[model samples]
Target: MPDIKDPLFQPYSLGSLQLPNRVVMPPMTRSRASQPGDVPNALMAEYYAQRASAGLIVSEGTWISPLGKGYAWTPGIHTPAQVAGWRQVTEAVHAACGRIYAQLWHVGRLSHTSLLGGQAPVSSSAIQAEGVNVFVAENDGTPGFVQASRPRALDKAEIRAIVDEYRQASRNAVAAGFDGVELHAANGYLANQFIDSNANDRTDEYGGSLENRLRFLDEVARALVEGVGDASRVGIRLAPLTTLNGCADADPETTYLAAAKLLGEIGVGYLHIAEADWDDAPLMPVAFKERLRTAFPGTLIYAGHYTAERAREAVARGWADLIGFGRPFVANPDLPERLRIGAPLNEHDRATLFGGEARGLIDYPALEAAEA
Candidate 1:
């Protein structure tokens, strides 16, 4: 008897927040927003609201400052209008009896001059990522992504300002009616830049030695916890296994484990990590992620090409407490219901992922919606 009860359907706790089920609506980058960089559209609200059956819903990456907008059209939390806009989003999710967390982001150096409000993108060092940013190319006939520009490194004063932005963003998320705030420390963003030695070549406190490099993220975690007070009201996302855009280090596993242990020590909610880049390549070995379960010593969320069967297995074996679904969630709004009944899922469309009208964003047919 393997707890015969579906591990995926069980209720769990991350400190003070009580989740209704273990299935999580993980953060997916849609890059859709209203003009002026601070407003979320009605479609995004409906899209997230319809999928509220999951235990938790983490929002798309939201910039905490103007420079944070490494890509165009992504939502932000730096203005009054943005807060009010998010208020509507939170109200809708709560009306559906769902809990939501906003992911605070700073896309350091992942932008071009056009995307940064006519300014250059900032980075940990004067290095550029050898990859493309997937945002809606404005002025083009149809929506699509493009390559980013080389970026300049941030000075110490600017670095301090960025930390303040995260602190303020955490406060703004609480005021906007979210249950918690998620620091976006993954996916080659600002915090991840500091974590990756290749991306971070500064001799300042935010670079060099592991402790020095990790200081910025630690400060962010502490500040976010201070903003919300309760550990349950705080969570973080980290993409530890990514070697994308030619970003590499001497030893990523050691670097990530140190970062994970630091977050666990900070005591601000759960640690959500990108378990692997995809099905073909998982960043550390399965054994390494399992070891991180103990290293974190808090609720651990694992995402990256995980199937329902695999998720259940991970939960049963204690490799992860919650499972964050990316692609499956993209094509299935009523994902929990579908999984419970072993229903067939709608395949996600690659064309409509980034910036589209409503084809793939909100048109994912739930079982009941389709039946009706």
Candidate 2:
């Protein structure tokens, strides 16, 4: 019998949505979208439906426009074809009684010219990201990682245009039957390029002072809220400490606390924090977590290298309202049940993690099938 007493199994209400458990399948870029159009397809739908047991599922980071794309073979939420493609995925998840949120993404300077039709990527400033490589298709159509291209700073008008794209993406997500939309503000993406001090050196209103640096985020969040027509259907992800893709803030706590407070005032439904998960990464101080909890009066989710025991402890300590399992969900479709009954998890195949066919995408067996 399952342990009903597990905290992860407790039902929680997130705005108007009631989650069956506290386990979340955080967004993971599978890079398996159909080629030539970057559209979600039947294989992707089956992959998500197989893992519909998660209390909440945040779909892979989806570009809001062709310019927002950084990686090869990822899905987009910008066009009619993309929207229709996602509708199939959402319908499949809903059929299995799962709730999903589309993660709106823009990679900013973390993109290569090949992916941008030879156009330089855009960022808060004309700075190129170092020590990070983005996936792209080479001349022979072979996909590989390449250094990010130099980016041109966006002028005021272009900035507004991208913001408008995000707004439309949010509406598209709803039209496609997503339960809500999550702004991909974390992972050193476009929003992070504007928020992080090291990345945004522009002296314009979108850069410099902390509030100034956050202006872009604020505008984008408001746009998302307005586009969704409900603040309760919008969430923002932030990575205060992570320097992923060469973006870092002078003081993550202060920057993120202010970001959280701003989102709170805007009344976004929740805040998802992506902790530094890399080996030897700095641990996010407990004090900062507590302060964030106080600043944002909404559902809080933390993801990164969390075990079931740690997840329960975080909930018990009031540090997190929910937990997101990343790679675990990749290999174990029934991750929640496995964690609930202390079942061993299947190891994910790292080589097959990126663009691939159904082998590593949806071939993982459920507990019942494994036992049988």
Tens digits of per-residue lDDT, candidate 2, 110-200, equal: 9999998999999999989987899988888788999999999999999999999999999999999999999999998999999999999
Candidate 2 lDDT: 0.94
Off by over 4 Å in 2: 1-4
Off by over 4 Å in 1: 1-4, 134-136, 140-142
Candidate 1 C-alpha error for residue 246, in Å:
4.2
Tens digits of per-residue lDDT for model 1, 1-372: 122489988889877778877889988888667875548878888988988888999999899988888766789998998998898899889999998999998888777777666787888888878766645456653555677778888888988888888889999999999999999888788788888888888887888999988988999899899887787678888877776544566777788888889988888678998766555774457788877876887889988877899889889888889999888888999998888779999999987777656888988788977788
TM-score of 1: 0.95
> In angstroms, what RMSD does candidate 1 have relative to the true structure?
2.1
* 219 Cα displacement, candidate 1 (Å): 1.1
Question: How well does candidate 1 score on lDDT at residue 354?
Answer: 74
- Provide the lowest-lDDT 10-residue window in model 2: 1-10
Per-residue lDDT of 282 in model 2 = 93
